[model samples]
Target: MHMQTKKNILFLFAAGVMLAGILGTSCKKDAAPDYGIPTITRVAQPLDSASIVTGSFTQWVIIYGTHLGSTQSVSFNDQEVPYKTIYASDSSVTVQIPRAIPKDVTNTVTVTTKGGKATFSFTTVIPPLQLTGMLNEYTAVGDTLILTGANFDLYGLDTTATSVTFTGGSTVNIAGGTASTLKVVVPASAQPGPVTVKGIAPLNISIATVAWYWDNRNFLFDMSNFNGWNGKTYLSSGPDPAPVNGPYFKVAKSWQGGWAWDPFCSNNCAMPAELVNDPAKYINYALKFEMYTPLNPPALPLKLYMVFNSGNFKEFFYDAGGGSYPYSTGGKWRTFTVPLSSWGNLQGFTFSNPIIMEFMLKDSNPSQSNFSICNFRMVPIN
Candidate 1:
């Protein structure tokens, strides 16, 4: 009986060991597949497959490489970029280089994935085309425009490609150029509006539209040129007025007093006759003028008013006491640019006709105020 029990115990122990081995084998988890280290082969545009050596801000880029689907992050010059996972695949990924200023040093594009990380060298570029000022805002056909700014093809190597364009789709030839300046002719077909300069690669900059009514004898009222002023009743000759150098008109008023000036349209004014009949042309146009206030009265509130031909008008008030406007009573010239659109709809008003501009003091105190006016004209905004 003892021998039989020992045999039964040995058989049961062997059976238990086999059952445990089967359960262990069935429950064990499968090992994950390995994706090799990521490698970047080429960077190109998705549509044309054209290789890209440099990239612009917000430009779409496709990166061709191996093991890219697992990428967790991408960056430009250590700055992490936002990307879409749906555009990524095992062999490639589509992304946009962040819209930001490029670093001075060499730029590197990096991709990180569960498999590994990869990097590629690239050149980042930004086109900065800003037009600071023009030598002459008003120019006749075939006249020259001196454009001042930075990042122009100053060497004039590619004049045909580098050009100045007008709103009418007319392009002007680049006569000369420098790093900070460009000389371009006003094409005969060019209309009076904003101008754009095209630079090499990605640079394109535009400036405010050229002035429609510029500072000339017909439009400007200065101590030297008083043709635009209505009369001399409310105006007096400036102090020791020299013809070319002194202020054109000196206006004096006591409390609750004012004066008016009307533009002289019969003179050599350059405003187009068509603009007077069409109020649409008045959009984006502004009246710009320079004013100098004497420091006699420390602070004085002033009100400016404009009356249109159709009996429509608008008023802009400046609180001299609060320094609301940037004018100081220290006899310094300050240019005020007031947009015509500030007055509501001007559909039926005739803009070319004589408009009355008046300035009056708002203060109740019995104090005298004096203001000098110069260089009044109309300029474009866009």
Candidate 2:
């Protein structure tokens, strides 16, 4: 009986050992597959596909396949990329790239990882074209055009630019933005159809289609702010000494110089006047006046004295029939052109000082005479 009991115990122990071995093997088989430390299989980045935008920023390339947790960082050129969100369980990292890299045929991206280092190359592509401001569909020929755009060289509009070109014989004056804006003039040669302007290179797109106005004068006349003369100040009526009609200014009258009605008095004289902000010095030197002869003409002969800064009025005196230049016969408006040459050549007066023109409407016969005055404009002959 003792022998039998020992044998039973031995058999049971052996069975228990076998059962534990089988269960351990099953657990090991059902566990999980091991993909060995994630690896970088030929890391790469989008070729220089960066695009230009009109706003404050631009878009750039991104790298892929730098291995999981092995990747320490992804950078452009050499600048460290600030940590952005990691995507897909360590598969990739999405980041905002910088534009400091110089544009060229090829750019570099560096990916550093625990596994190793990999470099990718891409060519920077030109950005797409876009238009901004002034979206009028139609622009007429001979109309002044102000084109607002971007990406142009500073030395004026490049006629040979591949992206954008002018349709008509238009002339564009460019200013502001290093090489980005164009102020173009619409040409008369352009046809009435839809005219197109394109920006070149990266941005090859049409900006605007301006309609041509056939008659600009008629259009301007209909405008409420329209005036026969250029936009300027005008005084038509006030006191007796003022001009006789609209579009006239009392630059200098007899009241200021005491030359109101008594044409013969020394004080009743018109003074010389100089232009305020004349660019061309010639405009400042010469004097021009349009006058209308009054119905009650002055009986006394009047002389207009053009005095330079040097007090030399004798040299510029107009010769009347009797050693006195007479005022108009008082009937019609007449245009008088006077060249500074008539004044003894003193390099004409400087624009800094006002040209004092004294009108000596003195009546030699002591008879009171008067006349009406009109507009005056002095333009450079050149």
> TM-score of each candidate?
0.42, 0.26
In each prediction, how many residue pairs overlap at the backbone (N, C-alpha, C within less than 3 A)?
A: 5, 34
Per-residue lDDT of candidate 2, residues 156-252 (tens digit): 2334442323444443332223344444445656443333455444434444433221211111011123233322232344354433233343222
* Candidate 1 structure, TM-score to reference: 0.42
The prediction achieving the highest TM-score against the true structure is 1
Residue runs of model 2 more than 4 Å from their true location after superposition: 1-285, 309-315, 319-330, 353-357, 362-367
